[model samples]
Every structure is written in structure tokens, then in C-alpha cells.
Target: MKLLTTNTLMVLLILISGYGYIASCTHDDIVPPAQANPTPVITRGENVHLPNATGVADGDTTKWKLDKAHSSVLWSTAYVGAAGLLTGRFNQFGMHDVTNAKMLKYPTPSRGQVLPDTSWAFYENDPSKIYFNGYVQMNTSNTGEPGRDSGCILGTGYYNTVKIIPGYQNLEINNLAKIKTTKVEFDPLSNDYIVTFDFIWQGSLASPLTQSIVGRLKYIPKAAVKDAVTGNVLYSVFGLQLNFQFDCRDFGVTSTSVADVIDIECNMNFNNK
Candidate 1:
């Protein structure tokens, strides 16, 4: 994969299933919606490169602008999103359509640990304030290829952010880790940034810490199918909460320090000119 980006560097720190499936919300609460096609990786380009000097220095809240000219792809997970390298790119800007992605799990890895994860973060403006947000999905199933074919994790919600505090190497964004959604707007009314679409996140690789992983994502809301027996809508947009708790100090770890609130904002229109 290419080098990390500013936002992806921020999400440096930070799931389950089926009853197997946790039916927290019921449908029939909202009205019908329309559809519009957004930009995908395919129309984006064939490759991506990390421009020099775009990332923030320690404690710097410098904005990382999208180099629309030399830049092709938008998301940074472009490379990591896939497991094996492929011969071609897809129509959408996700991962290689046929390439296998690096599953984010390394059970009892000699060097890395994959928390029963569900949160991702990035340094806000400054390399200080980290935003953390993750909503656990109901089914811990496996989906196809993310933002591409049809799967990643076969679940209801998609949240991917894993920070290796005080990152492993001397990499500047080292101690930091993050990923960003497409550009969003600062909402004045809600007093919170709303990203209508595209959840963005990627992490410090810090070092080449590897592990075994099997997870699901993408909290896309679908029309709750009428129950086979009752013909009733079954799910709604419910606000379910999950706390990703882990004390790095307990693992004989004294390197990276957790930040305050790492808020992954949603509710913005991230496509188009």
C-alpha cells in the first residue's frame, strides 16, 4: 500500500454477530428514500501516491488537502483494503475487485493484538484530539469485498480503526494513527460535523505487526424485509452503543497514550464537484 495520509494517521487508535444477529431496532419507522450514484474508485484512477510534506508535524492541526490533480483515488485503504495484488482495478474506488484483503485479526499474535474491535480514530486538526466512534453490528458475519465487489464483513455496521499508540517505528505520524471519510461539512445547527456518506478509516501500521482477522462492516440500512411469517418490517435506525475498552498499560505497554475523544463524524455529502 502507499504511505499513510494525514487523517488516516489520526485514526491511529481505537464488533460481533448473529443472535448471531442483534436486532436492536425495528423498521417501519422511517419513510422511503431515493437513490443517487456517487463517485467510486473505478472512475478515480489506476494508482495513488503519497505526496511529500502533506502530513502534519507533531501537534500540528494542518489540513491535508486532496490533490485533485495528481491524485486519483480518495480513500487511503486503497492498498490495504485488498489482500493479494491484482492485475486490474475495479469501476469503484475501493480495493482491487479480485484481490484478497488483509484481515485485521492476529489472534495472540506474538507482536500484535486485535481487540474485539469496533472503533477508529484520527487526530482532530491538531495531532492531539483524537476522535473515536464505533457502533457494533448485529451479525458478526462476513460480507464480500468492501466498497467494491460486495463484501468485507457481512454485518450491519462498518467501523474500522486500529491505533497502535506511540506507533512502532520512528515514523513521524508514528505515535499517531487514523483514517478520514470523504470531505464533510461542519454543521452549525447540530453543533457536530455530519458526514452523510463514506466512513473513512485506516491505521498506523507503525510497524509490520501482523495477525489473523475475520470481521464484517458497512452499516448500510436496508428495507427491513417483511418477516417471513408476520410480513412486518423488522428493523429501524436504532442508536445502539458500544464501548471499546482496553488499558494498554495492562499489557506491559507504556508507549502510546490514548487521547480524549476521537469522534468519527457522519452525515455529509462526500461526492461530486
Candidate 2:
């Protein structure tokens, strides 16, 4: 949700050195959309408390609604970090998480060599549907230059195409992103709403091929998550189920002839959450 270019440092340099492309970051606003029900993610008895002020109370159970105009979900997370450092919201933008597409994976190794980002549609007509589309970029440090940092393994682009089944059913995304909901169940043991996603590396040992990245792809949440209304209880999420199956494929070596799909399951909790 920051800059459009894959490399953030390059963006900074372009501004200072007057050699970067004009900033064209496009982010959409997310508000609940009008629908028959608030959201399946939220259940009636999910929360036992109610406010008399017509306003929702703490631990109120509400579905993750979409923005009618944007057709995107308002995914949020909690966090407690330094100012300008932690907004701690689910921070989900209008990503076209669908059948097959490119999505951006950040934290490039350096502050330069920024690449172009692809923005795809996450939804179109109905508010319930979702999509994710962007290109992934990663870099590393291989030199010990002073002041200005440079040199690291470059990475190949990876695309993700996932669907949020109408009824919140379950599916496995790249053997990492698991979604299951023929019947939805709340995880009382966990007090936080959970959405799991995985990123796989698909690079060749070559990048003599410029971006020869040699590491596994993992999904790390940068947004600080917190209880919807209160800015308390901040936490950032990292993938916990990577070892369960095959590790992320290396760049270029991955079989891009076909994309590896990762499924997403979002479960909202009441008390425990």
C-alpha cells in the first residue's frame, strides 16, 4: 500500500537524484458494501455484548464487508508500534485475488533496482467476490558499500490467483494457503481473526538473468493488526504452516508454465478474538 515501484529505495533516490519515475501509487478506499447480510464472517451469537448507543460495542461480530464501489474487502489487523510506523489495520487494498495473476511481494533486499507493480482487480460486480493481482519483488545485500547500499540477489516475478468461494469453502493455495469451510467454525483458542496466505519463489539459478534470487517465498504481514475500534493489542502475522508441505519454490526454477495457487480462509472471532 506504499509505492508502486518494487524498489522503495530507488523511489527515494529518484526523488533526490531526479532520476525516478513519477510516483503513481493507486490505493482504493474500503467501506462496507450494501448486501443482504452484513457478512458471513460475522455471526449473531459470535459476540454476546451489545451497545445501547446504536453503535457497535467491543467484540462486536460483523462480517468483513466489501466496498460496493471498490468491490474489495476491508481486511484489518492490530498493532502497537512507533507513530508513522504502525497503523495496525488489516490493510487489505483492492487486490484482484483471482484465478491467475501477478501480485507484489515486498521488502526488496536494497533501496534500489525498483521494478514495476501490476495492479489487478479483486472484485467487479458483487461485493461478496474477491480477487488478488500483483507482481512479487525481492532483493538482498551482497556488497559492503558505505552510505548508499547496493548489490544482492534479484528475484523473478511471481503471480497469485485465489478465489474467496461464495460460501467460504476451503481450498489449498500452493499447499500453503489452506481454506476450508463446507462448515465454518470459529477458533475460540485464538482471539484474533485469521487469514492465511503463502508466497512461493520461482527463480532460476540464473538471473545472469539480473534477478537471480535464491530463497524460499514466505508471506509476512507488514500491517499492525488490532481490535477494530480500539487501537490496543497490536500484532503482526507471519506464515506458521510453511514446513507443513513443500517449501516455496526457488525463482526461475519454479514451473511458471503453471501458477501455484494459494487459498485464503478468513475467520473472525468474538470473545477470544
Candidate 3:
């Protein structure tokens, strides 16, 4: 046995500490460790930075150019009478420019108050006053199963035993304009603009069906940043969320395994691009 000097013991301790740190940092399966739980730590502080101004400046007829990259549409249908649900999303779509949108104050949140008002109203005479225009290509849909996606949506072999033609190829949900909100409401705290609109769907089934539907839009505001040089701040950045339901039978989607009615939800975020 040899006695270790003080210098040698210090070197050994440093090597052990370094090795332990390296081992702790290395991942087992190339996955990082869970992050610390997020919680508000600041109660009051003078170092806090606040925006110079913040409000939805767009008036009753604010024309917004949608940010397509950040926008998306998702849909889900019952697999068998609510026993299970199959959800999918549309990869390609666009929002037609808005002409004149009605403006309403956001309802003040209170204790035991319901958040979303479900009462909806529609235009009787003219349906073009305010509407949403968008389309979904049947081929671009995804339901987590490649075989089912290609066969059911694209009419590949999986849909039918003999490989029949796809029933619905492209669905154009145009003329969603007749939908009139009973009242326009904005959430001041979250800057969420609430409106209900009627959506029209033009199906490409064997019979070429057409139907009108209603939905709700929760237009929430995204964060804004100020220019470093000019100090001009960016504002009015918003994202519109739509959730609605429609019958698949109307569009000729008569699959016993799938449900008759499908629920659609979309989110469209807009910026000053």
C-alpha cells in the first residue's frame, strides 16, 4: 500500500467531481431531463418592463390579412357513435380577407360566470355581410394512419374492397358569411374577440352536396414586440380559433365504422406581413 500525497488526493477529488458532473449531463437515450415546474415568482418588482400601449385598434370594420403559416384547421369525427373519435387536420387552406367586422366590448369576467356565450344568430336576408372563405383538400388530410389516410381520403384501396373512386376529393367551405354573431364580445384581459359565423361547405361527393353550418371564433391576440431602432411597436397581432360541427352524411360520407357528424376546429393567426 502506498500513501497518497495531499496534491494527489486533491487531483483525485477534482477528477471524481468532474466525472460525476459529466455523467449527470449525459442523457441515457438522447433525451433531456424534465424542466423545472413553471410558477410565478414575481409579486411586485420595479425592473418589470411594460408595453408602451396595448389594445385592439381595429374598428368595427378592421381588415386583417391572415398569417397563413401560423393558421391551421383541425377536425374530428366519432369512430362509432361516440364510442371512439377519429381526429384529422387539413394541411392546406386560406382565409379570405375580411371586409367589415362588427366590434363589441369584451364581457367582464366574474366569479362563477360562464366564459363562452353559446347563443348564436344568423342573417336572414343577406349572408355575405361577414363570412369566412377557406377550402380543404381531401388528399392532404392526415389521421395518424398513412394507409387509412390515403385510402379513405384519397380513395386508395383501403376505403373500398374493389378500390372505388374517392367520394369527396376537395371540400370548399365557402360562403361562411351568413353567420352573424348575436353580439360581438372581446375578452379584455386575453384580448380575445368572440364572434359566431355561419360556414358553408361545398362537398364533392357523388351527389355534389352543399350545406350551411355555424361555428364560433375566439380571436385571441398574440404578443407584440417593439422595433429596436425606430421604437415603433407592432400591435393588433391576432389569431382566430373556430370550432364547429357538421354532418358527414350530408357530404355522402356513409361509413358505418365512422360517425355521421364531424367536428371542425381551426386556428388562424394574423400578423402584419
Candidate 4:
């Protein structure tokens, strides 16, 4: 009877130990509830607005000079009945002389002239206050191909027959092109300047042809830079990017392979004089 009681107690102890071990294993296998990620915070920089032209001091004569090294004029034309575009640029071009009395004039409200309140960003609201005259040497036209470039200057072969005049030995003199801005209007919706300019080009025609073109001008205003050590203002720079399209046929190019429509982009940079 003593041996039987001892064996029964030992069996009860083993069963209780086995149950405790199984409960611990089951508790370790349980996973915690999933957690959601936190929301991210975004910060934006301050917005810088363009300066108002009317705010300039009265009689302020600030002249801007063209930075030729940073300026470029690019043109492209699609081939007639072809799938490629021919891109080229004039190697020589420059901004015409601008005077303070002509280019940068103050507003005259007493003369019944009113300036737009919101449209006075770059220049005075009056289109007459801003003037831009530029010239291009058409003889400097470069298309990367020596043969095609020569044809463009001499106006022969693939290009239309637009040779220089008989007496003019210099091709550059006869092939000169000029552009002068006539009007400038700001479009608030598109943030672009509607510019009307006259494009003057001399082809094989007896006289230079004039075509009035309307182009979209994008103005990029830059802040003035200062010397790091002296803290003195150095210079201020701005940019004007003009884009337009015109029919080349108007300039007397009658080539069948050359497309009539030509796209032009002029990225011009200017610095305060």
C-alpha cells in the first residue's frame, strides 16, 4: 500500500509539470497587434515674388546689358514629308544699343497714362518703357554639316537660291537679320509676356522682308549677388526666354524638302550696367 501511494503522487507531479510547459510554449507563439505608421510632415520654402517696376524711384535710370556668353538663339525646322528636325544656331548675334531715355522710362500718370497695378512686374506697365532690339548674322548659321552650312550662306544647292547681291562681297552684310520689339503685354493667366516684334530678314529678295511676329516671353528675375567678404552688392542678372514659330517661305525659301514652319527660341541673359 505504501509503494502504491508513492507511485500515484509521482504520476500527479509529472502531469502538472507537462501542462505548465505546454502553456508557456503557447504563450511565446502569440503575436502582438499590428501598429500603423505615423504621418509625415512636409515643409516648404518661402515664395519670392518679382519686384514691381513702378516702385522704382523717380528718375531712376537703370540700364541692362546683354551677357552674350550666357545668351543663345536656337532654331529648328522639320523636313517636308520627312520624320526629322534640323536644328541650328547663329554663331554671331548681339543686342542693339539701348539708352535710358528710350528703354527705361518712368510712368507719367498726369498724361492720362495708367499702368496696370498687377502687371507691373518686370518693366513699367507701359510697353513703350521696355525696348529690345537685337541683330543676327545669318552668314554665321551653323547646322553641323559643312556642306549644308555653305549652302545656307550662299543660298544654293539644297537651300533655295538666295545668293548675296552682286556687289556685296561680304555675305554677313547682306544676310543680316534684325528684330525689334513693338509691344509687350502681360498675361496674368499664363504668366507670360505677349511680345510683338518685327523680324527683318534678307534672302534672295530685292529688298529686306519684314514680318511681324508675336512670341511668348518668359521672364526670370534673379536677386542681386553680394561679395562674400565685403557684403557689397555686386550685380543683378535677369533672363528672357522667347519662343515663336514662323513660316520660312515668307522669307523666300522655296525648297520642297525644307519645311515652311520654323521654330525659334532665344534665351537671352542680361546684367545690370
Scored by TM-score, the top model is 4
- Winner by lDDT between candidate 2 and candidate 1: 2
Among all windows of 10 consecutive residues in model 3, the one with the lowest summed lDDT is 47-56
Q: lDDT tens digits, residues 161-203, model 4?
A: 2343433222242456667787888655555678898887656
Ranking by TM-score: 4, 3, 2, 1
Off by over 4 Å in 3: 1-64, 97-130, 153-204, 226-236
Full-model lDDT for every candidate: 0.24, 0.25, 0.46, 0.61
Ranking of predictions according to lDDT: 4, 3, 2, 1
Task: State TM-scores per candidate.
Answer: 0.19, 0.21, 0.47, 0.58
What number of clashing residue pairs does each candidate have, in the order they appear? 64, 46, 3, 0
| Residues 87-183 of candidate 1: C-alpha lDDT, one tens digit per residue | 1111111111111132322233233112211132222222122222222111222223444323232112212222223322211221222222333
Clashes of 4: 0
Task: Please report, as a residue range, the 10-residue window in candidate 2 with the lowest summed lDDT.
Answer: 175-184
Report RMSD (Å) for each prediction in the order shown: 31.2, 28.8, 16.0, 12.8
Candidate 3 per-residue lDDT, tens place, 1-273, comes to 145687788899999999988887785447767899675342211211111111112332233445455667787876685676777776545443222241111232332111111122212122223234444444456677876676553233321212223432222222111232333443334333344443433343433343545455554534465787887874446555777777766654566767767788877665442
Clash-forming residue pairs, model 4: none
lDDT of 2: 0.25
